[model samples]
Target chain A: MDIIASKLFFTGIDIGSTMSKAAVVDAEGVMLGYVIGPTGAEHRRRANMVMEDVLAKCGVSLDEIAYIISTGYGRVNVPFADKQVTELTCHARGVAALFPDVRTAIDIGGQDAKVLKIKNGKLVDFLTNDKCAAGTGRFLEVAAETLGLELNEMGRISLQSDTPVKINSLCTIFAQQEIIASLSEGKPLPDILAGVYIAIATRVVKLARQLKVEPPVVFTGGVAKNGGMVKAIEAVLGMPVSVPPEPLITGCLGAAILARDEAFKLINRGEYKLQKKQLSEAYIEFTEKTR
Target chain B: MSGYYLGIDIGSVGSKAVVIDGSRIISSAVIPSGTNYATTSAAVKAEVLKLAGLKEGDITASAATGIGGRNAGAGSYHSVILCDARGVNLTFPAARSIIDIGGQGSQLTSINETGQVIDFSVSEICATGSARLLQVVARILQIGIEEIGPLSMKAVRPSNFSTSCTVFLETEVITRISQGDKPADILAGIHRSIAEKISGMARGVALNPEVAVIGGGALDIGLILAIEEKLGMKALVPENPRIIAALGAALIARG
Candidate 1:
């Protein structure tokens, strides 16, 4: 009943470890709106709320969306989704939509860092940090905590430093100790910040190198928004990197694009069926399965 | 010969100074190492001297060990791996393998019959294997450091913790707390993780029998139990676990 009637829309939700995001696109694969919010403890609840918010922002109701997809670490927790896809695949699709020439994509999420090899906008090979927090966004979060500075401040301050110090510890906890020691020894904040970025870049690039990274590398994820991180990765990788606008919404955007493609395919085949979305039923099923 | 030999361990979490007379531990002191070396070493030194009823001048020779051991003002400094081996041999003569969980790092050392280090492994990748996590957990739980070990024994089933990365683990622990997981179960899981890391670092070196667990990690009864369950053996612990390295440094100074 809430359908726009004139146009068909596609919806995508990404329930990441740290944040939940949702995006809506028209049949032309143009993003109308996106919303990113804290995932919190209840993933299923957050996913639904985010979808509602994004739809409201786009002036489209859930009824207008032809297909919906979920992605990211908590993708499986989304019961209302028609399909679930991996963040890696969603990211590749999203990046290829933005940078058509992207051969490599690096996505550093809160819990993990991934170096994905992309061929023709499709994921080919990838490498991720092996259960180590060495090369992740959480490392920067700890540095921010230790320095008593905001996360945004790290990138801006690090730009001023011409000489960056080396961080010896691979672990974020021990790196905090090293940072404390540096602060006591009168090391400048900018130098330390630069060093921290370089440390993350080094670890991530090490993973990227193993994949035999090619040119036209694209960086995405919340960490990609930090200018210093991009510069550090570029310096370590000895190549420049491009970033998409609104870095956090890539997975959701990709999901929405995929939703659009799937819906169009069904429409072309005359096999399209208006999905009977039973949120309550899905929630009950989820609870029963979990129990 | 009548005077004492001193050994100081300037560790990241705590500093310890031991006074000994020909391998007989006369006195020792441990004080929290807050930020840097100067204050902690000074406090530990004064406390040990007070315990021995002697002034700093009364020490004949002194050696230092541990992360910040260089600033201990000792005549010589030794590696923590060597100190652990020497101290373990003295405490448990049959001990050929040692796991020392210190503030900054958890180390596993393989030793010969005479306490010479055959090989050593430091959890080089991260501090997840270290004792620092216990302090952080203690602060989060708002409990005394001594209470965590005993309280962990009460866990009916230790909670499963997937990641040992302290940064990730802290958030996970907080979530567990919010999700109404019992603190005892969380602590038990943490102890088990530390045990696993120590064992993980001992991958290449084949551990000889009569393994000993020393340093700060050995002080925790719950951790010992978890480690015992993990290794399937009874691990030896000295009377005063924290002072082993300082004791080894002192024994070295005596020679």
Candidate 2:
């Protein structure tokens, strides 16, 4: 029992623009518990809260966490993070763990969207829409607010429309005005919602198509939970996409996997004095070679 | 016998109707263009006629311009660029360039000495720099759109807004708000961003001296200043910028 207690346990924290997530995994890379919460103005505090929540859920203490890896927009701000990795790399690794055959990954988050091309569980190329939030979860949120619908309810309502209304404006503000005009024209709510989904899908598809995105694609991030978006993306891509059970935590999960791998390497090297540090050369080499 | 000519410009954001008796403007009305374009056009026409103390049948000719102009039930329709150029020329005779930023889109037209449009360019597919974006930002900031121009003038250090995409601008604005940025600074940043985008579009046109800024978006004094700072030249704005297009349409009706 004492030996088991002393065994290495890896933790990963992802502090995103809208939410922070933490995942715990054992030496075997099996997830023990995960926690997610809104990331308010204070990112460091939110990261700590998520970490503590996940550690408590897994019945593990802070000291028991052999290594802590952080990822996402606020990755560098994690006080206890042992290593900081980019969300793009984390998402690729996380999706590869769940779907070994995934050749492409599309992650639509609160304020950005990314499309990754993977080959044999490694990231080969990627594209990101960091300049704008046109096709991201924020766009959907604005549309939902305009229609007086809950974020989670958008997918279901959108699926009910037989013919989606055309949203001509690419700008969100203009799109809102268009939606208002459509409503006043007696267009059904479902049709307007469908139009919003299609608009997002169209923009995302254009981003994905920039790379050689092949089938066996995986969708990750909070937006992956939107069924209407999933359907719209699938229809645009003309192929089915695999979504992980916990899509929102994939970045954290990837960080956990990286932490577990690092812990094993340290043990093999007979370096018991574990100290919080930046990413190791081996990990950098691994990511570089994959690219 | 002298006759009255009516011009209606039904824009995406608002509608305007102007009545001109031969030489000078008599009455004009501006109202929010709701869902139904035909209804708003009819309403503005009636209001303008009432203000002029004349009947609709008293008008000799009528012309319409703008996005909904074709559906305005007018006798003739003119291109928005042409009307804008004529309207600006009427006020500022030496005006050689015009930047008309409307609700749904924007246009930059280069005119000759006679106010004939020589070259023109328009925003392709985005409305990020138009009046609609300002209205949306005002809603998000919980202030009236009319206040943004004045409030922005007080900004000592305007923040930087990188993206011209309205969708991304919203996130940036929210982030800035959360970061405790002053509303005046944010509004200044927005005006700067809009000016930058408009400048980018204006580069394709042969912009000369005596640039006249018109349309509903010209009401933002901060934006006008930003434009002047961006283009490195002063601009001429009329008393009621929103009525310029309608006035131009009325002039074309007289012809």
Candidate 3:
């Protein structure tokens, strides 16, 4: 028995479509460390390795971690998690932790898009578009490819569209064509960039309306770092949007907090409804009985 | 004597047949492409006959445009025509840019003031402009092609799809769907992608206000909106946009 492993901590892992993230927190809900890795083709296998590496890097042992929670698009694939939470709930909790007064959370992930309405740090209503990646980080990446601009450069370049063309078309393919047409027309590069920003901002605003969009809106996900998009969104909403530091990691942090809470609940009760799956003989007997 | 002409545009995905009496289209028919061009042509012929009714036999001549433009001949050689500057100029005399987007590919032609093909761009590699991509989305979401447009209009928070390439986009769409996005929003993303690609192709061409859009894909409201939004100018779409190319061909034959 290692003494270092005896310390108490809670862990949260978010298995996303493109990447995986892990976070650890103490019993007091104070986050200590975080780690991120690619969620390659082998999702579940990669998740385990990522979690193990995160624990090692954070100088925390598996024995010290009281509970493990999983979140994100691939949450269900996390075999080691004690509980799985929806990205919606986790994003709200994460934003709430960062910005206690945050009433709205806009999370644009790699493969999906989400908008959360938060009241008192709790999720009220949320809208998400997981059917296509037309307006998300992925779409921006694709559009950037046509312009031969790097992902980071798109926001800066988009700020350049002089006319600030409106791309009302909801489809990514149509948008691509429209962009090509603009390029052929010799429209200034900045104007095209500005147009893209407005399009994305318009999409977010449209979704934000579905939920009660109150001020003090917090933006998360990889797209939050796009200053052009941020300004565009602000201009559309006619208000300042707050962005949490490390917005992408908030989901993992929230998961860690929840894990810490679970651990504390178990410590005080001294009685964990033992996860039946942990008992080999009892699990077999239960399965046999059910069958 | 005022003479009328008929035009037939048989493309890979669909067929458009139109009868032009001077500048106005007397009748038009749009039908899906079956197994082969012959079958599709036959279908178009039947549909045209049905639409033209009494005027069907009176059509003095006919022309063909698009991929099968060279071979779209009925029994009569005097009635047949092919896609060219003369064909396009017959109907859209002032057209500066003629955009044709069908199910399989897209064509962008720049016509000078004299109604000549000055420069043109074609997209044959990327499946972005094809209906196959939309078809895949519809199948996965269990919706029809027509539903994609209206559903996309309802997207509160539309999803973003990167990758103008069709194969890559299909994977992205699947990932989004599994992530729990609305199908309508997803469809919107697909439309935007196509518009972006088409817009890129036309980037360098000096755009003339008298733009003419003719293709089967023109029926998709989402795609048209994307073009309009990006160009920042309203383009004229004939009543039956899909049959415009055919009308242009027929008008040429009438001459």
Task: Estimate, for each residue in B123-208, the C-alpha lDDT of model 1 and write its tens digit.
Answer: 77567788888887887788988999999999988888877777678657766775678999999989989888877887876677
| Residue B181, model 3: Cα distance from true site in angstroms | 22
User: In order of the candidates, what TM-score does chain B achieve?
Assistant: 0.95, 0.96, 0.83
Q: If the candidates were sorted by their DockQ against the true structure, best first, what order would they fall in?
A: 1, 2, 3
Place model 3 in a CAPRI quality band. incorrect
Q: What lDDT tens digits, residue by residue, belong to model 2 across residues A1-291?
A: 224423557999999888889999987888898999998756777888998899999997776677888999888779788889898888888899899899999999998899999888778899998876678888888788767789999899889997999887766666766786677666898898888888888899899999977989999889899898898889888889988988999899989988888766765565534453444444334333433
Give DockQ per model, in order: 0.31, 0.26, 0.04
State each model's CA lDDT, in order: 0.84, 0.85, 0.71
Per-residue lDDT of candidate 3, residues B1-255 (tens digit) = 376677787765567787767666777888875434555676787688677674457867776766544445642222111253444565567767877767656777777766667777777544576655776677667787777777777776667986665545655676687567887788877777777777777866666777766666667777677677877777666556676667667756776
TM-score of chain A of 2: 0.91
Question: Against the true structure, whose lDDT is highest?
Answer: 2
Error of 3 at B81 (Å): 13
lDDT of 1 by residue, A52-168 (tens): 899889998776677899998788878888899988889888888888899999999887899989999888988887577778998898789767789987899999898898898
Candidate 2 CAPRI assessment class? acceptable
Q: Which candidate is the best by DockQ?
A: 1
RMSD of each: 6.5, 6.3, 15.8
Residues B121-231, candidate 2: write the lDDT tens digits: 998667677877788789878899889899999998898986777766765676677668898999998888888888998876978999999888899999999999999
The second chain of candidate 3 has a TM-score of 0.83
